[model samples]
Each structure stands twice: as C-alpha cells, then as structure tokens.
Target chain A: MVWKIQGVEGENYLESIKNFLNQLLKSKNVDAVLVPKRFPDGNNTAQVLITDPGKLDDIDPLAPVQMVNSAQIVKELTKDPVKEKIASVLRPCEVRATIELIKLKQILDARLYIIGYDCPGVYNVKDYIEKLEKSNGIGKEGFTLSYVNSFLSGKQDTIRESCQLCTHFTGNSADINIAWVGSNSSDVFIEVNSEKGQSLIEGLAGEKIGDLIERNQKINKILDERKKRQENEIDDFLGFMQRCIRCYNCREVCPLCYCKECLLKPEKMGYSSDRYLRRATKKGQIKMPVDTVLYHLTKINHMAFSCVSCGLCEQACPMDIPLGRIYNVFGRKAQALFDYEPGRSLDDELPVATFKEDELKEIEDVKE
Target chain B: MGKNSVDFEPKIIAFLCNWCAYAGADLAGTSRTQYPSNIRIIKLMCTGALDPTYVIKVLLEGADGVLIGGCHPGDCHYINGNYKARRRVAILKSSLETAGLESERVWLRWISASEGVYFAETVKEMVEHIKKLGPNPLKMEWAI
Candidate 1:
C-alpha cells in the first residue's frame, strides 16, 4: 500500500521526512535511524546514526551532495550479528552497493529497514561547496530544496556525471522508495517494494492509500537524456591514466573494494627495488609509482562485476580522473558478458564465483 | 614484410597447468616435436591458480603475447579449475580491451597432457599470429 506523508502544521517535504523518522524513533519501531543530517555548522551534511528522537530534527533524506556511498557504514553496522533494527535512508546507488556487500559477505545477517529515495543526482562535494557559497546563506536544507525544485521540473543543470548516467535512480531494489518526482510540491510518496518495507510501515505514518504514484515516466525521460549525453562523452581512459599518480583513491573510496588484504599493496605487488630498476632497465624507461595501469586493470578485474557506478572514485581522485564513467562503462560490459546485474537480488549467482558447466562457450575458443 | 618485421620474434609467456599443458610441453620435448623457440613457460598447479594479474603484468611489462593452456572441458585435474580459468580469461580479455590493448594477443587453449603434437602446433600458431600484430604498444609507452 502507498502511504501519503504530508508534514504536520504545513512543513515542507524535507521537514515531513524528519517527522516520519522521528515518529519511528518515538514509537520504538526501530532502535536507531541512519540518515544524512546537517552538521552543527549548518552549511554541509553527512550521514549520522541517531538513537534520540530529538536528534532527528535536522535530517536531510535526499540532500544534493553525498560524501560516501553509505554502504560501507552499513557493513560496519551489520557485520557482527545484531538484534536491534536499523532504518537506513540511502540513495539508489548506496542501496545497490549494500546488496552487493551482502552478496560479497561484507554484511552479515542484520535486520535493516532500507528506506531509499528518488535521488535527483548529487553534486561533487567541491562543486556543492562552491554553489553553497553563492547561495548567500540560504542554509544547507534551503539550498537542497532549491535543487530538488529544478530536478522535479527536469531542469537539473549540474549533478555528478555518474548520477546523470544513472538508470537506477529510484532504487527499486531497496525495501522502500520515497518518491517525489511527479508530486506537486511538498507531498512525499512512500512506495513499498518489498514485504519488509510493508512491515516497517505497518502502523506508522499517514493513512494507507490505495492509489499509487508512478515515477516511471519521469525516470525514463531523465534516463533518455543521460544516455544521449553519455554517447557524446566517451573520453579515453588512457589519457586519464597518464595523470593518475597511483594514490589508489579510487579503490579507497569504492564501497565494493572491501578486501582486508589488498593485492594492490606494495608488498603484495611484491616488487623489490632491484626488480623495479631491472624492469626500468629493460623497458628503457618506466613511470614512477609503477604499475599505474596494472593497478587499475587489476582492480577493475577484481571488482568490476560488483561496481555500482556511484562515482565516489571519480570524486576521490585528486587528478580529476573520469573514473566514474570509465568504471561504469567497463563494469556494465563485464556484467553483460555474464548477463548479471549486481545487487538485483540475493539469489542471482555471482559472475565469477559460480558458473554453469555448459555456458559461456564463446569465451573459451580463440579465433583463428 | 620489412626486414625488422620479419626479424621480430614475439616474446610469449605461456601459463601451463602442471597436470596437463606443462606435462604436454615436456612430452613434446621428449617426442622431438618442433615448435617455435619464442615461448617462455610458467607452470602452476592448475589454471585456476593463475591469477589474471600475472597476465596483465607481463603484457604491461612488454611481452608480445600470453597463452594459457589447460585440460579440455570435463578434464580439469581439479574438476572445475579449467572452467573457472575460462571465466577469468574472459574477464582478463575484457579488461585488456577496455584499456585499449589488443586482446587477440592473449589466447586460451584446451590441450591435454597426451596431446604433445597438439601443444607444439598451438605454440607455432600463436607465435605466427602475434608476429603479425607487432610488439605490444605498452613496450614503448613509459606512462603505463
């Protein structure tokens, strides 16, 4: 059933969401709530896990900036067996990443009520800060509302490239999707996609309405615009690799890069200085911080199938590599080879781990 | 062909599974089967143990080609190692293509331990094919 959430006493959509979550806390439906909130400075937002209902006053459910994928934090919260339930409000990509983590065994069996929202794309933290400065103290929540207005009308100017290309913005894979794309101004549509979501909202928030809201038409329209833009910007990854200094920031920020013992470590890369010099001697020259291409290729090989195309890697790059596009394009291709979509469900087989004894015949034989 | 092109003897790194291709290559030596001398062999317990990183390393390090030889289907010494190797090889090739490298330079062949003659012919064929593709472009590019 669809739940229509309207702010009590004429509050806006952002404020309305805060009220709903606070209701959940007050009613004792969940032990803790994980949502993005404005820092005490009132200019920026980051995710926080709150236990007190009073602390839910400044929550921002779908702000226009994301500093992390949030799945990494979800993993930390759930890795050890937990009895208390967590209601995590996440973006579409974070939902997908969380599912991948579950399949990767990063998240153990933890009770989580995943609340996803229709993300209107996010700005890179740097771009968001620059826009905030020009907003003239409209405040973080106020600045975020302005962006949502443009997004609803299909006039979003500058979001991260990965968000622009994202087809899964609604996060249907999530338990619950908070929708607002087609709604009039401050009304929120609570869409329950799974049984778990239905149970979480059993006796909470707004009267149960039989009428459902459809985000498909608007979502498809934005995806069409994004697909067209993607065709025009097929930039060369090699050009970006030349500028990569091997800081491994892309790997560091990736939610799927959960390996505790990374093969990319210098010791596991296992290159002695003597071997390094010898390789240079043989090649006549070698790039410093060696294995630049090797590291990237190996990383993509390792985790491309599980990649959620979140663009955190691109945001993390100091040299401004278009790693978001590079990884998404390549990851989609890798996934296509096996006809596997990461995080679609818990039952789908991982591309590398399990294989049919009879499938993938073409990959075996080399052409003459 | 230009004199330099004709003189180009492509360097090939062949990863051979010990129970099959490694033994097959050894059999070819004892059987006096003639193949190109360009191949440098590395043996592993199984093709599944051959991490794709090793293939990327040699290709980036300027080897002209890579050949991974294992038991034919339903014949892996480890039952499913060859099947897993096929998937890794596919992923590795996809990675190479995405990086703008020539993926055709890498080959995966199913050769049994008893097929000494078949193993020799596969090497000769790989060497000739790589000769036409020329040296790996990564050989001269210092930026990696």
Candidate 2:
C-alpha cells in the first residue's frame, strides 16, 4: 500500500519529514524512534534514539552527512531483544547493511521497524564539515535542504564517490520507504514495501499514486552515470592501495565485517617480531607495514559476498584508498557468479554460508 | 636459487583434504605412482576448513603456486565441504584478480581416495603450470 504524508504548510521537505516523525512519536505506533538529528552544536547530524515527541525538533533524516552507517547502531540496539518496537529511519545503504546484518545474526529482526528513505547520497564527513563551515550558520535544516535540492537538481558534485556510483539508492527492502524522489515539494511518498509497513501506516491519509515513471527514469539515468564512473575508476585500484598504512579503519567501519573475534586482528594474524625480521631478511628489504595487500585480500575473501557497498569504510580511510569501489567491484563479481544479492531479501542465503552441490562446476574441473 | 626457468623447480603448496586428497596422495605413494616432487602437501581435515588467509600467506611467502585438493563432489566425508571449498576458491580468485594479482596461480581440483593416478597426474600438471607461470612476484620480494 502507498500513502502520502502531507507536507506541512509553508515548510520544506525536511520540515515536513520532522513533522511526520513527530506524529509517528505522538501516535504511539512505535515505542521509540531512531533518526539522524543535529548535535547541540548544530554543525553535524548523527543518528539519535528519541522517546519524547518534543525532541523531534532537531530531527534531520535527510542530512547530506553520514558519520557512520546506522546499521551498526541497529546492530547495537537489536543485538539483544527489546520489549518496545523501535522505528529506525535509515538511508538505503544503511537499510541494506542492516538487512545483511540481520542475516549475519548481528541484529535481531523482532521488535524493530526498518524505515528507509530515498537516499540523495551523502558527502564524506570532512567534506560535509567543510561545506557546513562555508554555509556559516545558515542553520542545519536550511543548509541540508539546499544541499539536497542542489544534489537532486544535478548541480551538486560533492557527493561521496561511492554514493555517486551507487545504483541501489532506493530503499526497496525497507518495511517503510519514505520517498521524496520525483514527488511534489508539498508531499512525501510513503511506500509500504512489507506487511510491517502496511500495518504501521494503517490509517495514514493520502491519495495512492500509481507507479512513478519519472522516478524510475531518474533512477535509471543516475545508475547509468554511476556505472560509467565505476568503469572509469577501475584502473587506479592498485596504485591507490599502494598508499595504505594498514590502520584497518576500513574493517572497523564495514557493516558486513561482523566478527566477534576478527581473524585479521594483529594477534590473530600471528605476527611475531622474529617473523617480521625473517620476512625482511628473505625479501632483503620489506615495507615497514607488511601485509597491506594481504590484509585487503583476506578481508575481501571474508566479506565481499555480503558487502553492501555502504562506503563507510572508504570514508573512514585516512589514506583515501577507493576501498568502497574496490570492494564493490570484487563483491559484485563474486555475488554475480553465485547469483546472490547481498540484501535483496532475508530469504536469500549468504553466498559463503550456503552452497549448491553442482554450483561452480568450472572450479571443480581440473586443468590437465 | 639462481636456477633458470627451465630448471626453476617451482615450489607448489598443496592443501589436501584428509578425507580424499590426502588419502589419495598416500595411495599414490603406496602404489608407486610417479609424479613431480615439487608439491609440499599440508593435510587438512577438509577443504572447506581451508581459509583464504592460508593461501594468501603461502603465496606471499613465495610459493610459485597453490594447489587445493578437495574431495570430489558428493564424496566429501563432511558432506558438502568440497562444495563450500569450490565457492570459496571462486571468491578468492575474483578477489585476487581485483588486487591485480595472478589468480591463475591458484588451482582447485577434486581427487577421490581411490583416484591415486589422478592425484599424481594433478600434481604433475600443477607443477608444470606453475613452471610456465614463473615465480610469484611476492616471493622474496620487498614490494607487492
């Protein structure tokens, strides 16, 4: 089912979303809400858990900055069962990552409402802060609304590289998808993608619009551009990876890299001083930070199949390696070979965890 | 150490699943089957238990090639272990390609315990392939 949450009078899309979230809080449909909101300083937005309706004043779900993938937040919130149902307003990448996390048993599905929105993509945190600084107290809502407008108008080019290349910007997997793409300024399109969404907005009033041709066209155009960029950017992977200092920030922020005891940890890597000296001796001279390539290779081997291409890892990288693109390229190939979509549905088994007996027969055929 | 490509004597690390490949290797030895002596075998409980890290480590340590020997499909003692191994190898190879490494340096083959001749032939074939591919760049190299 589809519904429209009418935009508030004399307010922009962001304000209307805040008003909708306020109503959601007041209606008691969910016991709590998790949405992005400006911090007290009002310069950045981060995901916040709100229980009081009045606190919705600072809500800014459409902010062009993402400090972290909120799937990690969902994992933390639902790792243990909660009695109260919590509605999480996420970007498409976050929702997909959350779904992948759910499959990995990192996040519990019960007592959680996954609410996602049409992602206009986001800027790297540093880039966002720079843009915020330049806007100079235009206020969070004002700045973000303009940023999103310019991005939608195709005048903005500061979106993170991963986001620009993202094809899965629609929150099709969410229970409730709050769509603004191709919708008029005065209303938001609420798509009930699942039964949970259907029951949640049971009495919400709005004209049920038919399938959006303009939105589909826009999505296709963006995807084509992204695919072209992805193709163009494929050559610089090795050169970019050469600069890695091996801080492991990429692993730290990766939503799919959910390991209780990560094998890539220095201790688990079984690195000894003697071993390092031996390696250095064997090579005559080894780089101070060894296993940089091996680290990436091992990580890709572990989670490439489950990768959601959220780009949080790339954002966290100080070395500026295009890890998001690299992982996505590798992930897409591996997932394609198995015909697996990481977060397409809960029913789709992870490629690594399950196997068909006759699958990958070419790998079985011994080359003589 | 200064040997030319013709007499390079490639160092091939073979991870053999205990249920089939390892037993198959043992059979080849007992049956006096002749094959290249270049392969160094590490017996694993199952190929599914083989981590990609082990393969990466050996390759980086300068092994000319990696040969993964799993049980034939449906013949794994752990049921679907070999099937899982196949999937992993596929993923590993794709990742290697993305890293701009030679993925062909790794080979996955199935050998049943009864197929001693096949085991010997596989070792000979893997050694020849590795010889043609030359030494792994990571082998005794300071840079990747």
Candidate 3:
C-alpha cells in the first residue's frame, strides 16, 4: 500500500515488528503471538510463546536469521480448539507446512491467523555469524541488520549457495504477505492472497496500493535471476551432499518434520547405538549413512506433497549438506506428478494419500 | 517365445479373515473349483488385523501381487476391522504409486462366507495378471 506509515514510531524493521507485537497485545482479540527469541548463548534458534508485550522490545525477529518451518507448532496449537484466535508470524515454509497439516486433519484452521514476509534468506545461526566474521572481519558478536541486509541486497558478498536458488523469495499463500523488495522511493507491495489477508489489509486502514505492474515486473526479474542462480547452486549442493556425515539437525529444524515416530526411530529403523559404528565401517568402504538415500526417499514418499522447501535443513547442517535442494528436486517431481503445489491450496488432498484410476496408466502399460 | 521359456508363475499372498474369506476359500476347495494355486493364504483373526506394511513389504520382497479378502463391510467378526483395513489399504496403495511403485500390486476385495466361487475366481484373475508382469522391479536389480 502507498501508506506513508512509518514501520515503527521511529525505528526500522526491528522497531516495526516490536510495534506490531504491541498492537497485537493491546488488541482484545489476540491471545498470543507465537514467536522465536534470541537464545542466551545465541548459537542457535529456539521457538517461544510470547504473551507479554514488554518482551516484544527485546525480540529479535531477524537475529540468527536461521530459517524454521513452524507448521508443527501452529498445528499443535490449532488442536486446542480455543475460542480465542491466535496470530503467528511465520516463514514461507511454515505457512506451507501448516497448509499440509490442515489438509491431513492434524491441525485445525479457523483457530489460527498467519502473517508471512518475503524471505531474504536465513543462516545456520552459528554458520551465519562465523561466515560474517570470516568474510568481513566483523566479529561474530557484531552481526546486525545492516550486516544482513547489505548481504541480502547483494551489495555485500553473495548469500549461501542454497539461498541464491530459492524460488519462493516472495510469500504467495499467506494471509498477509509483507514485502520489502521495492526501493526506498517505491511503495511496498502489500498483497492480500486470501480473504483473511484482505481483512487484515482493511484493518490496517492504510492507503490502497495501486496495481504495481512495473514494480511487480522488476520483482519478477529479480526472482528469475534468483531462480537461475538457485538452479546452479542446487546442482552443486546435490553433488556436495554425497559426503554427508548424517547429523539429523536438518530433520529437527524442518517445520514440516512432524513425524512423532519417524522411521529413523530406533524401534522402526533397526539402527541402534551402533549407528555411528556402522557409518564408520561403511565410510568409503561402503556408503555410510546406510539409508541416507532411503531415509530421504521414505520421507518424500510420505511428505513430498507437503514440502514447503523452507531450506532449514541445509541451513541447519553442521557439515554444510544441502538437504533442502535434494528435497526440492524430488519435491518438484512429486508435486508435478499430481499437478499440485504445496501451500497453494488447503482443500487439496496430499498426492500420496489420494489416487485416481487414470493417473498411473503408464505403469500399467509398462507392466504389459 | 524362446524354447527354454518357463511358464509364468505368479507369487501371491492372500490375507483371509477367519470368518468369511477363510470359509469362502474352504468352500471353493470343497467344491473342487479350479483356481490359481499361486496364492498362499495367511489366515488372520480378522481382515483388519492385516498390517499395511504386510501388503507393501510382500511386494518389495518379490511377491508379484497381494490380496486382502475380508468379510463384507458390516459383516466383520470384530465389528469394524474390515472397514478400517479398507481405508488404510486404499491409502497405502495410492502412497506406493506415488513412491514410483505400482499400485496394482496391492488389491482389496470382500468375500462372504458363502462366496466360495468369488474368492477362487478373484485369486485366479490376480495370478494371471501378475504372471504377465513377471516380478516387481523394486526387487529387481534394474530399480534405481
């Protein structure tokens, strides 16, 4: 919208988020704003539930800059069946994860409201600070918004290989999509992607944004450049990932990884305490992480139709494995098979759990 | 056909409920009805006892086809096991195809205690179709 509203009373992105939380708390309808807080050691990211408006002042939405798919947390909250509507600010992957969870009936819809923003990118908290220090000689403790924004704007050194290729740079399916891709002179592209989004737009009572044809075209060009860059990075990632050390941080950080008893569980996987021993034995002698490929394949079998490509897995890797691109490549194939896009529609059934008679005729013919 | 070619023999596993499907197969045997011997039966207390993994693992282990024959929807000995089994198997079949496995490898059918001929004929048909496909590629070396 062409609203002349300052993001904060006087501050920038940080102040704007703080003000938004303040407004949310004073509003009678909102009960909570589920959020993430900067940890004490500040080495990793942790999710938190924020009820008090005072805590909003210290909240750092952009700190750590690590991506998380928060679908699981939102899905868990929705099942409470509360009368009070809850609001959550989420990453794009989190929104997509919630959509799949809603479709699976694991979560309820009416109880939650979502706010999403265009993702500049996220870092593996520790890796981000380390890289910032190494690249610019800025100490790890000195990293800030100006540092991150300069890097994201590409005025600084390039972003991680995975971030460059991310296709969903803009939020497409959120209730209220926040945009900051335009120049300081041009107005922000505040697009309402749904009925709830439109309501939030009305509630703001901001000046209506004129159709941003030229601005949108410019954004699309940037996105196209990002896509091409992502494709090359994805290729590099897939090849590099063959050297994985099998840390499960990627699975842990992923918002959509909500399997309570995933196949990797000891009871299900048969890989007991000897997991590392087996890997050591198989290292170059045979491919270690015996079912690394199978583990991914099984997950894809179950959840590819629901994958949001949040890329937290790649960010969370200690070994710098690009799990997100590996997933997105297969996810793209699986999504295309059903002609369905994750997070695009809540009413659509996950492709794995639903079938049509005409869908696999090629397999039938191949059988003959 | 090559001179050394062997006649196609399908390997099929049948999970028959004790109440109806088992009786139906028994009836077929008593009547001397000719049906495919490719089927090896596993009797379950109820068709609902059949695990979804059993259907998938058997296919992965080289069974050309699998059949779960239970009591008609309401006629389960355990009240509603067959219905639950139906829902899970239907979901599993779709999921298998999505994973690049063929869905036809898993099939679900209902057989009453009186439907001896139907059980026999269903097996015969499944065996014939699977014989044409030979073996599951997931079990074959060609599968990536």
Candidate 4:
C-alpha cells in the first residue's frame, strides 16, 4: 500500500522525509533512526544514529553523495542483537548489499528495520565537492534537490558509472520505501513493501494512493538507456585495468568483500622482495605493483556471485579503473548461468555455496 | 623460447581429484594407455577444494593450459564436490573472458576410475588444443 506524507507548502522534499523520520523518533515508533546527515562544515554527509527528534534538522537522506555503502554500517550496528529497535535509512544499493551480508552471516537482522528510498544516483566525492563549491550560496539540501531535478530530467551525467547502469534503482527489497519516482514535489509516497513496514506505519495518517504507472514507465526508460551504455563499456576491461597500482581500495570499499583476512593482502599473497625479483626475472619485465590483474581475477572468483554492483569500489579506486562495471559484467553473466539474483531475497542460496544434481550438465559433456 | 616454432611443446597443468580422476590417470599409466607427455598432474583431495587462484597462478607462471578432472555428476566420493567444482570453473571461465584472457585454455571434464582410456584421450585432446592455441600471453619466463 502507498500512503502520502505531507510536505510544508514551499519546503524542500527532503524536509518531508526528515519530518517522517522525526515522527518515528518523537512518537517512539523506533528507538533511534540511522540516516545520512550533513556536517556543520556543509562539505560532507555521513550516516549518523540519532535518538533525539530535534537532531533530525540536518538529516539529508537524498544527498547526492555516498562516501561508503551504508550496508557495512548496518552490519556493524546489527552484528550483535540490540535491545532497542533501529530504523536504517539506506539507498537501494546499500539495502541490497546489506541483504547479501546478512546471508553471508555478517549481520543479525532480528531487531533492525530497513528503510530504503528511490536512489537518484550520486556523484564521486571529488566531483560532488566541486559541484558543492560551485553552487556558492545554496545550502547542501538545496543544491542536492536541484541536482536531483537535473538528473531526473536527463541533463546530469556526473553519476558514478555503476549507478548509471543500475536497473534496480528502486528499493523493492526494503521493508519501507520512501517512493518519489512518480509522486509530486509537495508530497512523497511511503510504500509498505513488507509486513514490518505495514506495522510500523499503522497509526500514521495519510492519503492512500494506488499503482504508480508513471513510475514503472520512467524506470523502464532508464533501464533501456543503461543497458545500451553497459553493452558499449563491457569489452573495455583490459584497457581500464592496465593502470591498476594494486592499492586494493576497491576491495576495501566493497560491502560484500567481508573476509576477516583477505586473500589479496600482502601476507596472504605471500609477497616478499625475493618473490618479486623472481617474478621479474621470469616475466623478463614485471609491473612495479605486481598481481594487479590477478588480484581482480581472484576477487571476482570469490564474490562476483554476490556483487550488488553498488559501485563503491569504483569510487574507491585511485587509478580511475571502472572496477564496478568490470565486476558487474562478470557478475551478471555468472549469476545468470545459475539463474540466481543476489539480494533479491534471503531465501535464495548463493550459487557457489550450493548446487543441484541435474544442473550445469554441459560442464560434463565433452565435445570431441 | 621460440614458442611459435613447430618444436614447441605446450605445457599443460592438470589438477585431478584423488577419488576419481587421479585413480583413472594411474590406471592409464599402468595399462600403458599412451597419452601425450605434456601434462603434469597434481592430485587434490577433491575438486571442490580446487581454488581458482591455482589455475590462475599456473597460467601466469607460463603454463599454456589448465585441465581440471573431477568425478562424473553424482559419482563424487564426497557427495556433490564435482558439482560445486563445475560451478566454480564456470564462474572462473567467465571471469577469464572478462579479463581478456582465453577462457578456452581452461577445460573441465569428468574421468571415472574405470575410464582410463577416456582419461588418456582427454589429455591427448587437451594437449592438441593447447598446441593449436599457442603459449599463454600472460606466461612469464621465471617461476611463479
């Protein structure tokens, strides 16, 4: 069911979201709320856990910048059971990554309420800061609203590439989704996607709205453009990966890469001066930062089946490699072969972790 | 290292599951079912334990091809190990394609203990395929 949340006549749409979250806190619907808030310096936004209703003033869930996939934050918060209920407001990508982490046994989701929203893709941190600086007097909220408008109108192209190609922009997996795809500026649609969402908003009064035909249409249009873009970029992996310096920033930011001791680490890779010299001797010429290609290949082997394509890895790359696009291409193919969609639901088993007797029969059929 | 010359012999690294493929290879040796001398076999406890990194390491270390031999479906001594191995190999092959590597260089097949002749023929076919494919482009001269 869809319900409308009223906005102050001329106030920003983000204000309406803040009002809803503030209600959740003030009315004791939830003990606390986890959402992104702008720093006092007006240069950054990060997730903050707020218990006080008054602290909702600076909450900007729609800010067009994501420093990290908040799914990791959710994992940190719920790794152990908490006495008080926490409502985590996350972007769709983060929500999906959180679901994957839950399946990987990194999170205990017993008392957590996942709140997701329509993600209008975000810009890279450096690019976002530059845009913020250029919009001199406009506050972060104002600048973000205008940026989102331009993006929805197809005039903005500065979003990270993974987001550009993302077909799953809506938070269908969240319990409660703050839907704005087809809704007007004066009000936002609150969708109760699951039983938890239904129970959470039981007493809140709002106008009931039916199926959003316009939203579905808009989503299809975006998907077509993204599929075309993906086809154009898929084969350029070798060129993009050539400049990697083996920094492992991509691995560090990935929410699904939840290994306690990563295989890519120096100790795990068994790196030594003698090993490097020997590799150099054998190769005749070796790149200074060795195993750049191997590091990526190993990562794909490990987690491509679970990759949510949030693109945090792309944002974290120092070499500007499109690691997100590369992983997504491989992930899409691998997941398709097994007819699996990671993060679609908790019930779907990871492809690598399970198998069927009659499945993948072609692997045994040797064509002479 | 004139890899393109007719005298060049492709080096193939084969990881055989001990329960089925390794026994089959041994049977081939004892039965004198002659196969090419290009393959160097490593016996693994189970194909499910085969890490994609080993396949990658050998290729990067100058092996022209990788051959993974496991038990037939439902014939694995450890229940469904071969099934899991098949899935891993599939994912690894797709990843290799994405990395601009020749995925065809990696082959997966089932070789039962009783099928020693099939095992010899499979090796012969793999060696010929690798010879035609030439040396792995990522192969380096020094040991990895």
Candidate 4 per-residue lDDT over residues A264-351, each given as its tens digit: 8989888899998887777777776777667888888999998899999989988888777888888888888889887888789889
Better of 1 and 3 by lDDT: 1
Docking class of 1: medium
Position B135, candidate 3: lDDT: 67
Among all windows of ten consecutive residues in candidate 3 chain A, which has the lowest summed lDDT? A357-366
* lDDT for each residue of candidate 2 in B1-101, tens digit (9 for 90 to 100): 54466868998999999989999999999999999889899999999999998998788778888899988888889988888888899999877776777
Better of 3 and 4 by DockQ: 4
lDDT of 2 by residue, A1-368 (tens): 56766443227777677777777777778889999989988988889999998988878888888888899999999978879989999999899899998988889989889998888888999988888889986776788888878867875467887898788988889998887787655467788899888766655555676787777787787778787776422575556767988898998888888898999888998889999998888878888677887888888899888888889988999987888788888888888888988888888988878898767776665454
For candidate 1, the C-alpha RMSD (Å) to the true structure equals 2.2
Q: After superposing candidate 2 on the true structure, give the runs of residues whose Cα lies further than 4 Å from its correct spot.
A: A6-10, A236-238, A366-368, B1-5
Docking class of 2: medium
Candidate 4: give its CA RMSD in angstroms. Answer: 2.4
Clashes in each model (backbone N, CA, C under 3 Å)? 0, 0, 2, 2
Write one digit per residue (lDDT tens) for candidate 1, span A120-153. 8999999988888899867677888888888877
Highest DockQ against the true fold, candidate:
2
Question: Which parts of model 1 are misplaced by more than 4 Å?
Answer: A5-10, A205-214, A232-235, B1-5
Candidate 1, position A138, lDDT: 73
DockQ in order: 0.63, 0.65, 0.09, 0.50
- Residue pairs clashing, model 1: none
Which fraction of the native contacts appears in each prediction? 0.63, 0.68, 0.01, 0.52
Error of 2 at A255 (Å): 1.0
Which is the leading candidate under TM-score?
2
